[model samples]
Target: MKSREWTDVGTKLFLATLDGLADAELDAPSLLPGWSRRHVVAHVHHNAEALRRLVSWAETGVENRMYANPEQRAAEIEASAVLPAATLRALVTHSADRLAADFDALPAEVWSHKVITAQGRTVLAVEIPWMRAREVAVHAVDLDAGAGFADLPNDLTAALVADAVAKQNTHGNLPGLAAWLTGRTAEAPSLGRWL
Candidate 1:
């Protein structure tokens, strides 16, 4: 599927999960360590805003950092965690809508413009949608709301696995895992507690 289509699918999965949560569930811990479901929702909202800033940078030829620093990003998420369930739900929905609009409004020519990600890698504005798609798809499961990798499109899962293996190769810490994934090894080697 195209990035936009994947983004839509991810958004639907995320929103459906959010919609089903009770107020108490919002305070419950998510699959991600140390993050409650509220934190997960807040992160998703903040991520949309961050990605929008990158798209804005591309369109205007200005440098817009996704966050001032890791501290600021963490503080924002913590601050947002106090929002009521209804408010948090609104934030998730509205931020996603605004991001989709921003992406759709970008001129075709500007899609090739470069912007820096939070990880400090320069990427084309065209890649932002896919970035958001990955965030929503993975975090939907992280929210512990019943969505899983099986619920995502096959193409998206395949793309994410390929991207993960490529990143692991670049990091040089998963040589044996990479060999196993690529069929170079007959049996998957033991890589204890990698995650």
Candidate 2:
């Protein structure tokens, strides 16, 4: 699927997954090591706003960064993760809607404008949608609300696996990576959490 399609599908899937959780479940530990379901939802909300900043920079030639710093990003997530369930849901929904509109409003020519990702990779503005698509789709599963990888769109799953492979491949240990990937190794490498 195209990036736009990925974005739409991911957003719908995420929102649907969120709709399944009761208020009590909001405090449950998420699939992400240290995050609660609330943290996952809040991170998704902040991500939409961050990606929107990249879009804005592309649109106007002004530089609007995703975050001032990594520490600030963490602080924001930690702070917002404690909101009431209903309020958190509404915030995530509104941020996502706002981002989608901004994405739609960007001119075709501006899509080729360069923007630096938080990871410091410079990519075309066109890549923003795919960035968001990955976040929502992956985090939907992280919510642990009966949304599993198998439930994701096939294209996104394929892309995600490929992406994981590419990132993990940077270890420069192809044989080790292959061994772990194929389940040949008794103990998989202690690869850190990515994304």
Candidate 3:
């Protein structure tokens, strides 16, 4: 599937999970250590807004950073975590809708424009959807709202595993894992819970 299609699937999956949560469930611990479901929702909402900044930068040729700084980003997430469940739900819904609008409005040529990610890596505007897709898919699991890696689409799971292996390779780790991932070896090596 295309990046936008994957992103749409991720968004639907996330919203579906979000809809099933009770008010009290928002305070329940998530898969991410020390984070509640509320925190996961807040982070996902903020991530959408941040990615919108990148899309805007691509459209306008202006430099728009995703966040003022890492500290500011963390602070915003913490502040958002205190919001009520209804407010958090609205935030997630509205932010995702706004980002979809921004993406759809971009000119074709603007997709080639370069933008810097929060991690400081430069990427083209076209990659933003895939980035958002990954965030939503992974964080939906993190929310622990009955979603799991097994619930994700097969293609997305494969893509994520490939991406993880590639990243580990770049960091000079996870050698031989790629071979196992690609079926070059019948026996996969033990790498416990790296994700």
For model 2, residues 23-99, the per-residue Cα lDDT tens digits are 89999999998899999999999999999999999999898889999997899899889988889999999999999
Which runs in model 2 stand beyond 4 Å of their true positions?
Answer: none
Error of 2 at 32 (Å): 1.0
Tens digits of lDDT, candidate 1, 3-43: 88899999999999889888889999999878999999999
RMSD of 1: 2.6
Candidate 3 residue lDDT tens string, 1-195: 288878988898999998999989999999987888998999999999999999999999899999989997898899999998899999999999999999888888999999999989999999999999998998888888788888888999888888777777666657667677678988876654434
Query: How high a TM-score does candidate 2 get?
Result: 0.94
For model 2 the local lDDT of residue 168 reads: 75
Ordered by TM-score, highest first, the candidates read: 2, 1, 3
Q: After superposition, how far is residue 116 of candidate 1 from its true place, in Å?
A: 0.7
Worst-scoring 10-residue span by lDDT in model 3: 186-195
Minimal lDDT window, size 10, model 1: 186-195
Off by over 4 Å in 3: 176-195
Tell me each candidate's RMSD, in Å, in order: 2.6, 1.5, 2.8
Clashing pairs in 2: none
